[model samples]
Target chain A: GAGVSQSPSNKVTEKGKDVELRCDPISGHTALYWYRQSLGQGLEFLIYFQGNSAPDKSGLPSDRFSAERTGGSVSTLTIQRTQQEDSAVYLCASSAPGSNQPQHFGDGTRLSIL
Target chain B: ELKVEQNPLFLSMQEGKNYTIYCNYSTTSDRLYWYRQDPGKSLESLFVLLSNGAVKQEGRLMASLDTKARLSTLHITAAVHDLSATYFCAATQRAGGTSYGKLTFGQGTILTVHP
Candidate 1:
């Protein structure tokens, strides 16, 4: 893809249900990131992936949150036993191989837990 | 830990007025990025400042970075109604390895330009 792509542009689920958000990064982009934006709040980093492995998962809010990237192209963020507080916009971003490269963001998946 | 703060959480100005949004960070950073987001839309990258005195401008918007003071500023010149949106400043730390490319973002400034 020419830019980062995210699936399930909007998802609304009942509390305690699980949800999965997907991201397809730009072709050949070696660095991928996940971020969460709550209503009217700043973005919070969730995880960072370099290639097929994640070097930093420190930002994951809880054990219920897990993410994985395959083939260094697509990634998935899964929230297990979702709570109402999990309602937010899940954004995916991809950058070129360097740390200084600007990240290109996806449209994001707006998750609403009811 | 890296922390970023943006001031003037909300700005309402006339179409021709000028304003500046300020961003301050608590620690040294490798780079600073400015992004704009319209309501219910994704973020759009505006500028990337890599050095202490770097400056970049596009159209009516200009961004500058001052690493010595851990600050960055986005200045709007003769603002227009089309420029109404939320602006965010993000900083990436100098740490390499797994922490690379991780951004710490400010609370963002919401700008509204009325005619």
Candidate 2:
């Protein structure tokens, strides 16, 4: 794909089940970011991955959330023991590892925990 | 903590009307960005400001950054219904802050331009 792509555009799951959302960043982008947006709300920073830098998890809401970026190209956000409030749109954006680079975004996966 | 605040959280305007959204950050930063997101869609990059007194415009929208004051503004000129959406202003935190090389976003302004 020419742009960032996120899989499972929409997902529904039980409250106790674990779910995974995938993000494929734009080619050659060395930085990846994950954010969560509740319905009709602003974005909340979740995690970030920068080239050769330690992934920042300061923004993750709780211990139920985790993410990993492999080979600096793809990322996955995993939610463990999801609760009803865990439902939200998970957004992924990628940017060049330089300053002032415009971040490119994916459509995001709308996850619903029942 | 670095905080970003956006004023006029919601704006409703008649077609051809004008409005401006203000973004104020709690710390000093040199880079700012504006993004637009439609309902159920991803973010679209609108403008990137690199320094103080930087100004950029596209079609009906214009953005300016004032690094000294740690503020940015998104001005909507003669807004149309098509421009109605959520606009987000984000700033990169300084190296000394808790969020280094990380973007802190405002609460977002929901603009609804009625035609």
Candidate 3:
């Protein structure tokens, strides 16, 4: 309730199966971000949303990855036909409207593709 | 495209020792952020450096920014076992109203402090 919250802390799916990860940002936070981190790798930006509208999706790896936000509060990241390479920790963060504000992060969802 | 690089991908230090982690970016950015992540845990925001010469300190960690050099540093003072974690630095550049606040992150520095 006080910090960013992500659902399905751990998810295991088949290589071809699709999965949806959910993020509930801090109440009143207007900026939400999605990032993916592979094993022993740095975080890779996936997308960012401002008040239910994604301003930049360039960081998305491919067409199979998509995200959407509704009511300016909750967001979902969908991965279609997942591959083994897609296994990683998906992190969600939220911040205030200001550009200089520090982001508060969720515990992150660890996805495993089998 | 913005590229971020961090030096000393791994560090092992004795307790009470000090160290600094470096972050360099290829393009101009409006802000820099530092974060800490423990094993199997999500990141925790450590600092936000907004302008050149900006510096912020929390506990034993201090972060500084140099816009002209496109560099940022996280200095750890008197390291403790509790400070053992992975540290990351991210840079953000505003392209326009739509592409604002997108961050490009550096490969994290994994620090291990021994007692």
Candidate 4:
């Protein structure tokens, strides 16, 4: 089976521009999550979706960041007015519908703000 | 709020030696997870500890969790060059009906194994 897939493995954009990162979860995975990794911040959870509805969004850094999942399989994270601080690797993960199931991660999209 | 921390943020070990990475959480968690990531790569799930005494081993790596102490350990036995990577430990707290699968990750430990 194919693992989680992410598009635009690398994206370089000017500050204040908007960028959208996409994620394709594994087949039959109902739980999806977004995470960010940076040099200063090791790894941080951004949001979590359960069956198309996001139940947790507390991890989002600011109002400019938003994510949505459709059909419970694909998710997109959009960052508006990107800042130099927002430059990092955006990782998406998915897992089966279970309490303690481990999440499988995608290659991640590296976002760089120039 | 949940906080997870890992010690020895940087480790350099010799091949064939043994070492352990420690993870501690600030709150009670439903599960503990270990992940490995290579340079310019995403995380790879290593182990999931569900119980206080849960211990799992794969190849030269072993993981154990002590829920009572809110601690988890990833031990490398006879470290090899291939084990060089960043290791992360995450804890998830159960909320209401669904877990939501939100992970609180610790600062990763960068491990380097050399001959």
Tell me the spans in candidate 4 whose CA falls farther than 4 Å from its real position. Answer: B98-100
Off by over 4 Å in 1: B95-99
Better of 1 and 4 by TM-score: 4
Displacement of residue A49 (Cα, Å) in model 2 is 0.6
Note the chain A TM-score of all models in turn: 0.96, 0.93, 0.96, 0.98
- Cα lDDT tens digits, model 3, B5-84, are 99989999999999999999999886899999999888998999989999999999999999999999999999999999
Give per-residue CA lDDT, model 3, range A55-109, as digits (tens): 8898898999999999999999999999999999999989887676888899999
Interface RMSD per candidate (angstroms): 2.2, 3.2, 2.2, 1.3
lDDT of candidate 1 over A25-112, digit per residue (tens): 9999999999999976669999998888888898898999999999988999999999999999999999987656789999999999
Give one digit per residue, the lDDT tens place, for model 4 in B1-115: 8999999899999999999999999998859999999998899999999988999999999999998899999999999999999999999988558664688999999999999
> DockQ of all candidates, in order?
0.64, 0.55, 0.66, 0.79
Better of 2 and 3 by DockQ: 3
Q: Which stretches of candidate 3 lie over 4 Å from their true place?
A: B95-99
Ranking by lDDT: 4, 1, 3, 2
Better of 3 and 4 by TM-score: 4
Clashes of 1: 0
- Report the TM-score measured on chain A for model 1: 0.96
Instruction: Mark the 10 consecutive residues where model 1 chain B has the least summed lDDT.
Output: B93-102
Error of 2 at B42 (Å): 0.9
Best by DockQ: 4
